[model samples]
Target: MTLYGFRIPKFAALFFWIVVWEIVGQFELMLLFPPFTEVLAAMTDVVTTPSFVEAARITAYCYLVGLSLAVVAGIGLGLLMGLVPAADKLLNMWVNIFLSAPLSALVPVIMILFGMGEPTVIVTVFMFAVWIIALDTRAGVQHVSPSLKEMAFSFGASRVQRLKIVLLSALPEILAGIRLGVIRGVKGVVIGQLLVSIIGVGALFSLYSQNFLMGHFWALILILFAFALSLAELIGRLEQKVEYYAGARG
Candidate 1:
């Protein structure tokens, strides 16, 4: 970032906000926001607790399992839609609808079908993540050069070979979609847990909120934010690495 003709580090904005938060917290400007330092201190305590360890394990399990399912289903659906115009015509409208819908409202339906358990949370994450990934993948596959497919065909490449070529050609957009899906999946997991209110981090959030443990609450939030940002950054790096594929396609 630049300010007054001087370059500023990207984190400078974060630091400034942290300072503001601390000041407001110190002055008791908001009842919901406790001191930042207290929250940091509470973080260590929170992480060390056995309950937190168990909750973390459950949350991680649900997140990973759900996201894995999303990746597989989304990519497959995207490939199908991209390759088959009939599939695209049949499913594109619903995909777009779900992508734009307030997915939280659907969680109760998932809970009813899957039961009020980890399965529900997993499905929630999958639901939140899958559509965008499929859409992006479809876009990437559709944008693959016709000449590339023609060359593959002329070379006697099998159907699977052609599909592989399309996947590689669309790698950049696929990665981009996955990155976005990951972020949404995090939100899904959190929201799912919160709505469920009996499992994972959501349970802990309920515990903290009911008992007025704001410090611990905020600490957990910070942890979630950090995890989401870290994963996004990692995927973004991977996206950059494959950008040449997009250029090649172009």
Candidate 2:
């Protein structure tokens, strides 16, 4: 970032917001916001509680399982669509529709079908994440240079070899999609648990809200935000590392 033609640290904006939030919170400008210092203080107690430990475990399990399914299915579907015009014609409309749709409305339907359990939450996370991953993967695959494929063919590369080449070439976009999917998956997990209203971190959110424990509530939010940002930064670094593939293809 730059201000007045001077370079600013990347975290300057975040620090600025933190100061603003602290000021607003200290002055009781919002009923929902407690002092930021109190929220930070509550973080220790929140993390140490057995209830929070159990909630964290359940949230992690649901998130990882759901995201794993999304990655596999999304990549497979994307490859199919990218490699086969027929598949693209058949599925592209639906993919676009789901990608743009407000998926939260469908959560109730999922709950009805899967019942009020971990399965429903997992499905919610998957639904929130999969479409974008598929779309991005399809784009990556389609963007693979025709000459790369031709070269592979002229070299007597088998069908699997061609597919591997495409995947490697598309690694940058695939990782970008996964990084985005990871973020969406976090929202899914949180929304699923909140709507379920009886399990995981959602239950804790409910507990804090009903009792007006804003400090603990905000602390939990900060933890989730930190986790999501950390994951995104890690994936972004990986994306940077693979960017040479795109340049090579060009």
Candidate 1 on 87-125: residue-level lDDT in tens? 999999999999999999998889889998999999999
Q: Estimate, for each residue in 1-250, the C-alpha lDDT of model 2 and write its tens digit.
A: 7889999999899889988989999999998988889999999999999999999999999999999999999999999999999999999999999989999999999999999999999999999889989999999999999999999999999999989999999999999999999999999999999986469999999999999999999999999999988998999999999999896478
Give the range where candidate 1 is weakest over 10 consecutive residues by summed lDDT. Answer: 241-250
TM-score of each: 0.98, 0.98
Regions of model 1 farther than 4 Å from truth: none
Deviation in angstroms for 1 in model 2? 2.6
